[model samples]
Target chain A: MSQLHLTDEILMAFADGELEEPTAAAVAKAMAEDPTVAKRIMDFQQSRRLTRSAFSMALMPDVPPELQAAVLAQVASYEADGDSKAGSDIKPPQDAWIRRKRPFMQMALAASLAAIALALGYFVGWQAEPGTGGLIAQLESPLVHHELNSSASGKDVELPFGRMRVISTYRLANGSLCREFQLRSSTEAAEAVACRNSHWNATFALASPISDAGYTPSGGGDPMAAYLQSIGAGQPLVDEAEAKALAEAGR
Target chain B: MPAGIGQELVALLPRLRRFALVLCRSQPLADDLVQGACERALANAGSWTPGTKFDAWMFRILRNYWIDHLRRMRTEGMMEDISMQTQLVGDAGEGPILSRLVLSEVQRAIDSLPQEQREVLVLVCAEDLSYREAAEILDVPIGTVMSRLARARRRLMEMTAAA
Candidate 1:
């Protein structure tokens, strides 16, 4: 059969291990006979691997505390209601609980960020002294270094000034790994990008009050997003890739 | 909820969370979806027949909840929240950065797929559901699942190759 004759559906089935035995055997025979067919099958297999790996993290993270609690609570409530009973009466007060909890969670996040920022400022100021390249040098302080090296994208790393969320990561044109993070306190938010060289360099940093709620990590409205775009950052490095780059940089 | 049912639901959380993450592309939202689905599953636990696949039933509930949430968001004009776009990008624990990067690239490629195709791909490729199971979860014909998976995989390859 011509290469074009092998439909993507058949190939996809083969990749997914969904092909029936005889058909799968036929495809295996054809693959052995045809290098192009073999290559296509290999590519399909690779895509399947990639697809599976991308979300594998979901399985690794400890179930979020809230979720775990919710599950246990449900089980507990059901048990309390006497195992056989079922209905709306036994429903966990999820809506009311969420309503009460969301604001507290938001405030806790805000306060934590604030405390982190304050401490970071004090330490950075104490270390930078005068004429040490100001904030750029401050951005390279040991705390920042530690946070950058240790935290993965989408995680909030506690810093002296506030909580730093490593929002996105990318490789620069020159092949250095760059991380874009948003540091936020109760009152302020700053978006900064740092690239690894011999050490982490604050390639760009911008801070403002929490007014830019409209700006997203990837949306064009955010200055950091624009900056990354201008620098031709093709795509952010995955968490593992970012960690490896940091290690290589001796961070 | 029956003790057996509760245990089964708890056991299925990880897989459900994985499916939710791929569908919503945001961790917070994914967790919310899972929580909601679990609640619904428990409340309506009697609807599930004995010996049926619990995972498929939960998946259907999760997908339905997601679709409903999307519709509500669209109605409320709240879909533009940038924070909603953030996705937790790596395993919480340790892994190779190169593999993670490749995974992230692959994820972005998948994220760019149309919703229909993306859901099918997630069910078959990531969740490892059989075509029949996926079709049932999606409430579509088996042929539909196969076609969507094919298109999704093709698009993913093209996008990643271009990158």
Candidate 2:
């Protein structure tokens, strides 16, 4: 038989185990004969693996109790009706519940964004003080510098305002050592990013409420979140890698 | 209708939500979609075949529901919300920002694909559905499924390589 001309679709199907047996045998023969064919098959397999792995953590939120209750309520309603078909035309609780919930969600989102803006404006007043060139000279305080360089992710250090905690440390794609920190005063809290060069400097800041247990993005349009994305920050460092990154920063 | 479907749906909740997230790209919307799909599934329980693939059947219903939702949104002039909400990718106080960064990067890449390719990619690669099963769910020919899968993988590979 003439050498089987394998298109990408055939190779993909062969990798996916979707090809017929004889065709699969032919592809196997092609793979064995041609190194390139094997690599193509491997590429297809790798793509499948990458997709599977990416979705392994596919931003799944915990199932809300209301949703569970709604589902069970639906089932219960179905069962309660002697004829399930009678319930078939009824509107789902989720339909009404979500309709009622949407406006509230949008309002909450708008309120949070406004609060973040107000906070950013308040925080910007500090930058206007005479000689500081738009960046907060936070590291000029040796104690703050020491804490930022050596503090573990969850450690709390007392700041003059209230309290400061390093949320995470990671390297930007350009190999800059950056730390995400939350500064909580008695009344207000904000998450800020600082990266070190000759010294540490605050890069971006967002006003976040002190009420939340963990830092959350102030909705999608916030600047600090965009900064994180633009800088290509990878996953926060694990303990060992964090130490190594800190050490490399000459701590 | 089946004896264990309630429990099965409970078990499948996370995966269904994940699939909805991949399609809808918004947490609140995905939750609503999954709940609605579950409600529909229960209300139409008698139509489900007893011994067939339960998850695939659920997936088909969810996918059909999503298409209908898109149509409804278009009719209501609400199509802008989908694009605006696409940027909202985190699990809302669930995971650390650390992992969310990496995951969101992967999500951005996946999000860049055309919707047709995205649906096929997620169905086959993430859900682990067979091509034939996906074809049946998508109401497309098997060849069309393979072609879409091929294009999606190739685009993803090129993206990974460039990144």
Candidate 3:
């Protein structure tokens, strides 16, 4: 007999409980008889079990029941506020970090231009291949002193020219790692932190601008804000060594 | 629209929440993401057209958001790994809760899958979406979904089997 090759859609239909009773029964019977088919079913079941387990916890976050009510209430309020005004356009604080990030990028761009120019001058003697400069740049990055340690705090900071701060210290479900941080006072201003793992992730919180200065961190009662204040100017946020330390620290 | 639609949207939360968690495989982040999705859905409530499955629409939004999140993640220097099969079973869970062990292994195993395959698994197994519906949400042909899913299932089989 030609071997029966089960398609994923069939397995999926079976997995999702989408198969009609008779068909499902047949699949069950077949799975029981064929070890390979049985294994496939188990794998699908395992995948399902995993997804359910992970997401199930996320759903019931013990978000203070009152907080849940509050979030919903806030939603209602936002809908009501939609027509009354321009709507809360508070451009999340991370936008400030994003804005602050602009200058260094321009610097990096300028550096690239300079590097290219130097490369061209040095290679002028030969009709080199088109891809030469890239290879040179790659080799040269290691020669420079600016190093990023993937093993540091599992956290690293990136500021255009100014300073930033750490946000949360938590290991991600994935082994990659994560850290949260914010930018302190700046006129083009705001708050928020960026997270990253040893791999160089920089995830910024949703855009939330800095709240008014009058509201003390104690008054605001937001952990994110109080933490930013506690860090002081948030300057010298993190260096390469510290970054590596955070990475290795596993958070 | 009347409040009925709003209530309907709220009703879908449990299922949607389940889908979000499965995709991200992290409870805390999953909750955050679901909250973000809810906020976005409500904020753009006016844009929802009648006669469409809100779940489907929300799934699309969630899928797009996830893609964006992944793109943003790429800039952070994510590494790719291809581990040996023998070690797969060696890492199986050892915890108080039997379910937790199974669950954690499942989560890690799912994570090992390529992005394409993982989405298929999420759609078919986690979200209970039909192949055709998954096709629409993923913006791909039904066959493509099937192909990716087949490949994903194969990979999962490889990763989960005892060495």
Candidate 4:
């Protein structure tokens, strides 16, 4: 191959291992014949390394618990809905005897009844049945309303259905107060961003449930994160600032 | 929901998150993308052929979702401020000044590339996808992938050298 024929694209392809064997062999010959060619190839390799190292932290951070739970929950729900090939083979973990004997099961039953009651009471204005309030109502329960009204940013409230935590409070460019909160229940979790007008309008909401495993409360897995980025939510209000905002808004 | 699919999906989370980070360039947004992709993957699990490459399918879904998101943001006039917040500079006492400056400059150079070039570069160089695989994921021609990757590298080299 002529010295001038070793183009930058060819060298990059050779460095990236995208070239065919014969072409690679020809490139190797060109590099051997020319130190500048070899150095350019080396620079490409080093740049790739630097690019990888620059974002290496992405791989290092732990997968947020909410995300893990979301995946597991979806899988479990799929399986439990009798869609899996192994659904018939696998038995429920609790047998009749265990369920009849365990006091924990009784407590669970009671808690479930209480949850049903709370859902009914909270959605009474919109719907009589539990879980029938549609997506907006499912997110805007009495507890969530109270939490949004009473809790300052960065505070958590333990409600009957789940734990609600106010992540951040900010004002939109239109001068309306917006709050991002996370609601985590035993079976599912949701993150929502609501902007206050006459009432809180859910600008965005996403839910990911836990699988058979019980609930665990953690932070930072929000499906609306990208939307929030688009909207340019600069920084969350700190404690004092959140308090001041809430007070000034007469909340 | 297939017998072993759950475990496989779980195993792929870390890599998926990394790829999402490469696409979105923000940790929280990356996680959001992963979760959204997982939801769609679960809902459409039956459509996935049994013997197909699952990772490629998932990556395609994520890329499509991101594209749709970008389109929506653009329509709403919300695209200009979507830059990822990276803390490139640390406290003066934290690290050597020369090394920190180099790192910051390298990051800025990478960030300055156009989104198309950045995506291809991340897929090919960072995620170790072959040119063809990156093309498949990005739904672009193989030659397009190669050209974009080359342009990204050339731009990075020029910017960093100038810095």
* CA lDDT scores, all candidates in order: 0.63, 0.67, 0.46, 0.62
**lDDT ranking, high to low:** 2, 1, 4, 3
Docking class of 3: incorrect
Query: Which lDDT value does model 1 have at A77?
Result: 71
TM-score of each predicted structure versus truth: 0.52, 0.58, 0.41, 0.52
lDDT of 1 by residue, A1-251 (tens): 43445777786676456667677667767655665555465455445555766655433455677897898788667656664534542222112112111323223322222223333331111111113233333466778777777788898777666677888778877887788876766655556777877777776665543422332122112234445666678777786787786677663
- lDDT by residue (tens digit), candidate 2, A114-231: 2333333323211111232222334345666677788889889887756788888978878889998877666456667778997887666654333333323232223444456556
Docking class of 1: incorrect
Tens digits of lDDT, candidate 2, B48-155: 666667777788788788988899989998685675676335455545632554533345677888878988998887777778777777778889999999998888
Ranking by DockQ: 2, 1, 4, 3
The segments of candidate 2 whose C-alpha lies over 4 angstroms from its true place after superposition are A57-59, A86-251, B94-98, B101-105
Clashing pairs in 2: none
- Clashes per candidate (backbone, < 3 Å): 14, 0, 24, 0
> After best superposition, candidate 3 residue B161: deviation in angstroms?
3.8
Least accurate 10 contiguous residues by lDDT in model 3 chain A: A92-101
User: Candidate 2, residue B32: CA error in Å?
Assistant: 1.3
Best-matching candidate per DockQ: 2
Chain B TM-score, one value per candidate, order as shown? 0.81, 0.89, 0.67, 0.75
Model 3, runs deviating above 4 Å: A1-70, A78-251, B2-18, B21-32, B69-104
- DockQ of the candidate models in sequence: 0.15, 0.22, 0.08, 0.15
Model 3: TM-score for chain B? 0.67
